[model samples]
Target: MKKTVFITGASSGFGKETVRLFHEKGWNVAATMRSPEKEGELAALDGVLVTRLDVTDEGSIAAAVKAAVGAFGGIDVLVNNAGYGALGALEAASDAEIRRQMEVNLFGLIAVTKAMLPHMRERRAGVIINVSSVGGRVTFPFTSLYHATKFAVEGLTESLQYELNPLGIRTKIIEPGGYRTEFAGRSMSAIGAGGIDAYRQPWDKMVEVLAGWPMSGNIREVADAIFEAATDGTEKLRYPVGQDAEQLLAGRVQMDDVAFKKMMVGQIGI
Candidate 1:
């Protein structure tokens, strides 16, 4: 029997790549996105079911999961990859943006996981791969709101590991560093406050650094890591992809809070 994997954010980036890779490897793929109608390629592939799923909406999540189960028997792996990056200064972010960040990245992820738990628990088998970022464990000059939501994901996933493991459900966090994806392009939103001139210099500097950095890791690396996490059958909770993620995560462990902040400030030229 072919294993079925239900992936969120499957319209593009890591999620889309994962869907292709999994389908190529003979897995039944529930490739879901907010606008499944707009997806042409994946929907044409064999054993791939492209459906609509908006993580922030419970009805959409439930309906998409139902469609996947109906099409592929049951979901063996669930990938929570439907999130956008809310960048820029925290002060510049409105209440709505902040809440929206948490809604899609944190709360939405939790809700999807919860919705899938009963099915996985009944079968006593499943893997949940969350596409968190290196930002989850580290911080930079701007992107405070985005970092907050990702940090919450890291903490939540860590804790859930303990509870889900005994029930045979695996939780894995994919922390990608600098990836040249829609995440840094169309999916990224930079929040700006009208009168916050004090933050402008730092934000510009940070943007310049990120834009010029040579750390463009392939999205396929992240897709490969997710595939491994789903099939590896290990207790490993976190998989850091890219050299940037590996180095920064190591630096976080080796350096103290002040030292880390100083390094970050200097890097961003703050």
Candidate 2:
């Protein structure tokens, strides 16, 4: 019997690539997105069942899970990957924008995980992979809202790992650095007329450097990390997935706060 994996935000980016990789490896794939109609290529794949799933919608999450179990017998792994970046100065962003960011990035993930827990617990075997970012561990200038959300995910996944490990299930968080994907284009948002004025001069320079930094890793690296976390039985809790991610993690571990800030300013020319 082929193992089944269910992935959210599977229409594009790391989610889409993971679906392809797992399908090629002979696993049954339940690839879901907000617009199933937009997943033409993924739907045409050999072992994939594409479905409509809006993570922020509880009903949509339930329906997608039901459809996935019906199609693949059961889901052995769940990848939570549907999220966007709300980038702006904290004061510049509206209350609604902050709430929206939390709703999609934090609450939405919780909703899907809550829906899937019963099924996984019953089976006594499962993997849960949350796609976080370096921002989860480190901060950036204009991405306060986005960083807050990722930080929440980091804590959520870490806490869940301890709780679930005793129940024969595993949870892992992937903190990837900048990757070449539609993430920069489609999933990023900026507030109105708040470009450089909203932040201090140094902060604006840091934002500029981040915005211009080349994406060093592709989707394959993240997908591969997800795959390894799902299949490997080791006790590794967090996997930082790219060169920038590794460096960021190292710096955070090695440097004090003041030193880290100075290093960041020097390196980014801020």
Candidate 3:
């Protein structure tokens, strides 16, 4: 039987590309999104199940999983890609912003994993891929919340191995560096220390620095990485995509904390 892959945030970006790639590879795909109605082609694709799934909503999670399993028999892989970045000065973040960042990035990921655990555990097999970022391993100013959740995802996936590995359930984390996805357009919120004079200069510098960074339009590379993670069938845990991620992460691994901090500080220019 053909394997199945269920992906969250499949409306666009890496998730959408992954859905198409998997379908082209002749694998079943469950393309779950918050607004499936907004999507037109995924449902029409052969062996694709387009459904509603909001990671923050338990009911939606259950429903989406049920729909996928009902149609495909069982999900061989689960891709957790529904998340956003709340950038800006830490002080500028409101209560709602903080909660939302945590909910969609961290809590929602855990909830989805929990919902899939029983099914995978019973079968003694499955792959769980969490979409993280270079920020998860490294950090920059004005993005504390995004880093926090991604860092948590990194740690969470790593720790899951002790139990999950034994159960034949492999886990992988995708850390992409700079990507020209809706990440900056729709999937991000830039709420800098709102009008606070002390943060004005710093905010400008941060924005300028970020705007100069290289973000690739080749997002299919990331989807390819996700597909590899699902089919590689190895115990490998992390796949960092993109040249920027590869260089930064490699530099981080080679340098000590102080040296790494200095290098990152130089890059951010703040």
Top lDDT hit: 3
Cα TM-score per model: 0.97, 0.95, 0.97
Per-residue accuracy of model 1 over 40-157 as CA lDDT, tens digit each: 9998999999999898889998998899999989999999998998888788788898899899999999999988999999999999999999999998767888888999999999
**Which of the two candidates, 1 or 2, achieves a greater TM-score against the reference?**
1
> What is the Å distance of residue 185 in model 3 from its true position?
0.9
* Model 3 lDDT tens row, 147-215: 999999999999999999999999999999898889988999988868788888878998888788788
Better of 2 and 3 by lDDT: 3
Candidate 1 has what TM-score?
0.97
Which model, 2 or 3, shows the larger TM-score? 3
- How far out, in Å, is residue 107 in model 3? 0.4
Q: Please write out the lDDT profile of model 2 over residues 1-270, one tens digit for every residue.
A: 999999998888899999999998899999999999876888888779999999889999999999999988999999999999987677777889889999999999999999999999999989999999999999866678899899999999989988898988899999989888877678877653365463667566766786789797567999999999999987687999998889988999999999988887687875
Task: Compute the lDDT for candidate 1.
Answer: 0.90
The regions of model 3 sitting more than 4 angstroms off are: none
Q: Which 10 successive residues of model 1 have the least lDDT summed?
A: 186-195
lDDT of 3 at 41: 86
